[model samples]
Target: MSAFEVTQPEIHTRPIAQTELWELVMEAADYRCHCTGGLCGSQHSKTGLRCPAVHDQTHRKGKGLVRLVAAPADLGLSDLAAVELPVDQLQAWCPSCYTAARNRAREADANARRIADGPEGTLF
Candidate 1:
């Protein structure tokens, strides 16, 4: 039995309205993850050349099954916000890459805010 023959993957829970957008992004991505070393912290084996993982396929590194998502290329957006974007604004992402990228983006934003606010609790 194939993986698809089993129940739906956790990554595939996008609402029905989003399915068309998802397909558009996936197709543009050639059904492969677009992550380079920048986001996924990948080794570049699945790295610089573009991730080899395909939709509904086993991951190259055996981390888990590969389930790509159509999300905003800009990791700065919250998941809720990203989901609300149109298909043209989205990019194909594997879950691992997405999580790492989102975390990094949020941290960067926080750091920028921290810098702008100056040292915490400082009156000067």
Candidate 2:
């Protein structure tokens, strides 16, 4: 194996551009979530859930929690670049999509590990 034993990536503080963050949030929301669509408090009262985008997914058998990892280090706090606006809003993802993403990541990591281990056959 290579000297780097597939350790988790170090937590680097990367500065996020406000425009980029906004785009990410909007893209995740599709301008349809409670945070963007102006339906925050009421929707949850009726059904104990937030975000219309996710609500719609619930009918289709989805967990509906936002998969957007804008500020994981912030402990469930959305990243806010300015006092007035969140840098990245939450997202809506189906459980299957989330699982697929996770599986893809795992496969990629396994491929990386195999590469690190080098050729299977002995050269000498």
Best-matching candidate per lDDT: 1
Best by TM-score: 1
User: 1-124, model 1: which lDDT tens digit per residue?
Assistant: 8866877555543436667778778879888887776666665563455666678888877877787877788888877887678778888888887888778888999998888989778786
TM-score (C-alpha, index-matched) for candidate 1 = 0.74
Number of clashing residue pairs in every model?
Answer: 1, 0
Instruction: Candidate 1: list runs displaced more than 4 Å.
Output: 1-17, 43-47, 119-124
User: Tens-digit lDDT track for model 2 on 1-124?
Assistant: 7997787864322226554664465456553343222122233444445434332224333454333323221222323532344554334333343344445555667787878798778773
Q: Which pairs, if any, clash in model 1?
A: 44-47
Each model's TM-score, in the order given? 0.74, 0.31
Root-mean-square deviation of every model: 6.6, 20.8
